[model samples]
Target: MRTALAAGTAWLLATGLTAAGAAPAQAAPLQAAPAADAAPLLDAGSADGRRFRATGRLVGGGGTTCSATVVHAGGRPDPAAKALVLSNGHCADDTMGTNDVVTDKAAPEGWTFTPAFFHDNVAEQKTFTMERVLYATMKDIDVSLLRLNATYGDLAKLDVTPKTLADRRPAPGTALRAVHAPSDGIEDGRRHLRQSRCTATAAVPALHEHTWLWKDATRTDCLGISGGSSGGAVTTAGDTGRLVGMLNTIATPGYLGCGLGRPCEGSAEGLVVPKDDTAYVTPVDAVASCLTGSGFDLRRTGCRLDRGTQVTVTPDGRQTRSTTPDGPARWDVRITPGQGTRPTWVAVKSGPFGAVDCTRPEGYGTPRRLPAAGLEHTAVLPAQDNLHVLCVAGGPDATLQGAAWAASLAHPAYAYVRVDNTPPTVAPRIDAQHFGEGDDATYWVRPVYAPWELTGYQVKYGPRAGTDCADPAGYRPYLNIPASLKASQGPWTYCAIGSDNAGNTTAPAAFTVPSG
Candidate 1:
């Protein structure tokens, strides 16, 4: 299982600071690192730590914490230039769905980045506020670029200099060192800069985890990666190493299949889960072209990144919603091309649930040419039972010439639709003795169903014996029996309905509670 490194409560507990600055223990401990290759803590006063002072802890709204580093696109900029910080897109916003891109948005209030963050010198660390989100996306890659309110001149006063971005990804077997502030299982050392020395292994052409897909990820055996290590700087190993990539995720132990916490490598054949524990880094070189001496400019001639497209599907395509099995389902799709984009062709494809390879072209139908002025169309997907995935992609014309055109086709703007028609079965078990006794006797009903097959269960109760099984109204999300009805005398009838991802509901199952 390859899991993202964004930390939740582990970040709070490890740092002993809440969003409100209260010290409280709430989240579970983070996954433990392998004992043989545990990363060593880097002292802030050490020469190497000072050399990489730009690497720091990033704190976002809603208790989200990850590692990030200040970076410059070209040569050192004028000291007055606003600094840029890079991290994983999910680290910036965990709610970001597949193929979603966010740009030029105001930064969340109170979001801060602390450089020179050594666990031993927590009080001395300087925190800078984020000003704006320059670019963020989880489409072909997981990355986010943020602008800081502070300028390079401001950081220079603290003896902190931004790392220079490499023009390209490092070759395989290249010596690498990851500098990050992990707050998971480190106890008192949480937030301290840790260094992991390793070598790049292979480049994954396509990597899939949960709903998001990433491309050209570099796999390495870097140890000590866990919650809060995301967006850490992965640099060439040296006293003056340059930034090559950022830590994105790691192969989690004890998980059997490829999913969340278990990223799988995708190829034409299928998905393959790595057998060993390792960490993956997303390249940052593509971002260099989008930057200039002034700042980020998505319209730059050589920029290959998506300018930010809008793909909306009626009835909500982002999540699984129910529809009639084997029945025609019409989808109204609207795609607004990003600024400066020349999207000439759009295509859609469907495949078995969780089996679609967005990177391949074999399954996609004929491409539809977009009008010069508008990009709106209605698409009808093939009817099927159970669950299926529908993917949409847009790119430049295939006949175009130039590297930029080729790059656009190689990394197109894409979105996914999870359609499900299957309804889950529920078996309700009642516990009579454990709750209460006599008139105050409480009944605890446990609805047992396959979690992968169902989204949730709904329940309703009444004194009447016969209730319509197909009625969709009046049922509430399943919880314990209501306290007001707990002491009711006569027999009570309870009905439970199971709902799946597609909003399809099963027939209600009835249960009777005998009078005491």
Candidate 2:
């Protein structure tokens, strides 16, 4: 997760790819609950305060993630060749085996990811520049870079000139801005936190105490920045259009969207920061590392390197089918290299899904959706040395069909779920919610299960009780949750929407609630 840093102009935050942070209170040493019975390990709105960023996957089982832009040490600008890719170094545990091919011409899902993008590829991509792991001592500074040998692709195409360390140290209190990359599942950019100052420091890992320059706690928002979004940039736009550092990371959620569960709120929520006990990266030269060599002069032309880009290649799927979501669906297997990540949505909706080229604005085209046959299934595509492997589906059950998928941004080819169900994750259950006299309210739920049962959940609300639980009709059920409770006209009479994964669904269990 990204955190406070020495960079100015309200630095941005990064996803996970580093050390661990203050461990949350032990899960009360949980005991096994019924097969599918459980509650939310956390509330729908409390996860944001943990001082971490979303890794775009189910972390600790499930969470939300965002992205930032990152550049190499030395490089020139040319969109055709190189630029920064807002992704993670070792995604989902960096399991990229040689069997997982990073097609120089054909990528897994019709995209080309080079050695520069791999975690081990660090040796190759980092050649032109120096590499130094940021210690937890430098919390909010978990950033790294790859000095490029050439420039092309997005950076050159967009002529995006990044701001240097000096340009960013804003006049204290100057409105610092937060930035985000919607490439992963995020669709908007309103995710800016605040330009903060490193107030004090102690013997902590990669973090530094900061005098956060925020308007108020109510205005702060955060997501767990996990795997895929490794070395990204978190800066603000200067009148000149250059960017600077805000925060970087070492790790994010273990899985994509952390099960797409609603983010946590309240005390569990904390500002994002660098991994634990790591060193700080406040040296101006180090900050300059993200740019070009000092003598190279950035004002003229930007870095001279193309770090990473999406390459298209046909997939190895042999089967094709047709059908629809609401009714019967249809699908054709041209599994060849198609453009875009996050293809799940577009493909699931129609045939193809939305992908990202980051080099441009149009984003990407929709490709075929996954889960070819089964539901709630996950695949493990390792790209360590370009290794590939195939697994067998054990059985066909509801959980199997409607479950989670584990993928790696570095690998992009493999995704699977926890086949073994010994440590079952508990589904979330809403015991009861208390609405006080005025505006505050509290709801109780379960926690994460052993076999990754229920990571957390989704909440909805409305004036009517029996409205669509999965997709609430009105704003009643969600009136109490963080993002949804923005428009509460009265007090704590917030209704319950829906909860899943981490605990048993309340909509299925609770027969009724007081309708507001």
Candidate 3:
């Protein structure tokens, strides 16, 4: 349940203005810091010449982490197939299923890293251990991809697919911008942000080389890059935007360890890699050449190394798309032809406080309500049917009480049928059915894009067994979907219910409990 928006952390990738006389830029905008101001990253910028800068939080209060530009060896972002792109595997590993303990023994070729929480924040900077496998799978070839997790706060949203990373690498020396939630007092408790030049490419393609990598600032006011600042990006300056590598570890590693709810260290250490840090880019090309027994031109997809499938979306007249393994979280959308000048298209799931994750079950991003009480939002099938609407009643035939429902263990159940115009675009017709797909399942909730006045969802289910197939009582209803029946057992009765924002009356959308 990651978000589509990484908020301001990774937002720096947005294209910028480089006109000859571009107006003077203001410092990064930041929130009021906790009274201890400037005490955290107290003396980071002392050393000069370092690149990269950023600030970010862990998902669901994961923890604070920072990001910086790769100046020395990784000065700017590079889309060059030559460099490797590294990260903690779990950054986008939700497809492996939740709570899945991480292990590197199963590391494969294409798996990118995860939210750098455990890796950067662990007690003693753990090397790949049996008990402490890196999250997600790892693709070593690139020297800078390894990472440790850290905790700061929750993340906005992110796009983590092979396709997403494929062409995102910028040409070497591109104007790279970085930011992250600084754990130190670098920028008065606020994020320490910075813009810098990506220097050059790494000499080795091995992922382990990352262990020997270190930072030496040759410039000033560079304190923006501080602790927990791993897994960020280094890009180039231009009309076209790209992603070179993420802000790996930051500034310096501290033995003091322990951050957020985990054991961590190196309050300052930035780490990352070339965009294409995989198991084998060149040799694999030869392998592909040998596999086909012919010179294989596999880079056609534009990625130095193909990672996974790509997912596309036509958002608000834009053709931006996402390509991830677990079926595109579909976020991380960028405008082509013209970069940063346009807005990043997103499904706008939930508002500010309601993000899509376990801890913030409140919803995605922020919380939105039906203008009135007792209404449920939903979407229709087929992308063309975007008439997202709200329900003020139960079954289409149910009374007009405007009963709504917020029934779930995570959220409180409320039932107020006041009829309002605020609700989720009726759950996007449950596509990828991660759960069972039986008749009892609600195939799709249908996103109710625009708001409308209503009572609740029109859920119908049930057909009693052993009763006359044609009898009215045999036709019970449920909010749940129907299941395929065994032999021709008389007409199955189902339940019909209505849901609104406050709560929905559960009368139908149900099936008979199978007997032993």
Best-matching candidate per lDDT? 1
Candidate order by decreasing lDDT: 1, 2, 3
What is the Cα-based lDDT of residue 8 in candidate 2?
Answer: 15
Query: What clash count does candidate 1 reach?
Result: 9
Whole-model alpha-carbon lDDT for candidate 1: 0.67
TM-score of 1: 0.69
Greater TM-score among 1 and 2 belongs to: 1
| Local accuracy of candidate 3 as per-residue lDDT tens digits, 9-55 | 32111111111111111112221122332223222232211221121
Candidate RMSDs in order:
7.5, 20.2, 25.7
Query: Evaluated with TM-score, which candidate comes out highest?
Result: 1
Cα lDDT tens digits, model 1, 146-175, are 999999999888878888778788788988
Pairwise TM-score winner, candidates 1 and 3: 1
Model 2 TM-score is 0.27
Clashes of 2: 194
